[model samples]
Structure formats: structure tokens, C-alpha cells
Target: MKALDRAELQRRFPEGVPVQCGKSSSSHLVSPNEIFAVESKMFFLVGPVGVILSFLSGGVFVYSNWSNVLGDDLAFLFLVPIIILIPWLIAYTFIKNERARISLFNRHYI
Candidate 1:
């Protein structure tokens, strides 16, 4: 879809969002929805990257200590679950919060 023009954007989002055009040192005032959209998009991108990195790091740790890993059955099992879950939980929390924030902003502003 085509991007919204400044006036269209302003009409759609009137609570003053921040927009940074190219080569501009300062951000332009837009609407809350615009800012929230940008922030939510950023969080969406970062969340997956964080999850992938966490899994990779966990894999590396497991591989690096492969010799000792198998011997500690409980530790090994617990490690895998924790490593997988912790990142998932963190990412989930962030996304949830972002959704809630966006929802609230939409309700109040747009």
C-alpha cells in the first residue's frame, strides 16, 4: 500500500507522533498511532532476532560442553528447557506489552 502523506497521517493520528525524515537531525511531530506502529514494528523485528540468537547461543553452549552434557542427565534436560523457555518467555512478554500499549493508544488517541 502507498504510504500516507503528512496531512493524511496527521488527520489519522493527531496526538503527535515522531517521524524522522531522511537527513533530518530532529524528528517531525506526527501521531501516536504512527509512533506506536513504528515501535511495534521494531519490537516485532527485534523479538524474533532475540529468540533466534538465544537459541543459537544455547546450542553453542550445549555443543561446547558436549562431553560433560550427557553425563549430567538432569542438568542437561533442565538446561535445554530453560534455555528455550527463558527467551520465549521474554519475547512473549515484550510482544504482549507492545500489543497492550498499542491497544491503549488506539483507544485513547485514534
Candidate 2:
């Protein structure tokens, strides 16, 4: 996308405009939806990477502490399902929020 001047921004997004966007990569934004577009890097970190790490961490925890789990008569074992589902929950939430954010965008990023 091209950089928008104040007049173009006002004409394009007549509802409103944001004064500035991005702390490290500062620029004017035509709309708040731009924030989501600019900050989309978080999706990878909290989505796929986070899900993978959570599964790996959960596996390690279950493996290293298997005996304790059995010793507790499967009480500690209950955590396994929660650990497994947490990634799906996180991913679903991010996807849902992304869909909502996309609906607000004046133009599509991808």
C-alpha cells in the first residue's frame, strides 16, 4: 500500500483517522484496523508457535512426571487433556478475533 497523505486518509476513511501508529515503526494510520494489520506478527507468536510450544511443554511435563501421575491414582493425569486442549482454545480465539478484526478493515491485507 502507498503512504496516505492527510487529505487522502480523510477522503478514504471519512469516519475517522488515528494520529499515529507503531512505536518503533511510526506512521500515520487511516483507521484503527491498521493497528491489527501492523501488529499481525503477534498471530504467529501466539498462534502456531505458542500451540507447538504448549504441546511440547505439556508432553515433557507428562513424560518427566509420569510416575507421580500414576502415584496420584490418575489425578495428576487429568491435566493432560487440559494441556492438550489449551492450544486449540488459544488458536481458536486468535482465529475468531482475527476474523472480527478483518471485518473492520477498509481493505484486506492478505
Highest lDDT scorer: 1
Model 1 clash pairs are: 17-30, 17-31
Model 1 error, position 21 (Å): 10
Please provide, for model 2 over 34-103, each residue's C-alpha lDDT reduced to its tens digit, 9 standing for 90 to 100. Answer: 4333335677676777778888988898898888876856766778878878888878887787666555
Backbone N/Cα/C clashes per model: 2, 0
Q: Model 1 lDDT vs. the true structure?
A: 0.66
**Clashes in candidate 1: how many?**
2
Q: Model 1, stretches more than 4 Å misplaced? A: 1-39
lDDT of 1 by residue, 26-92 (tens): 7677554444333447777787888898889889878987886868566776777688778789878
Residue range with the least summed lDDT across 10 consecutive positions in model 2? 1-10
Candidate 2 local lDDT, residue 20: 51
Error of 1 at 70 (Å): 2.6
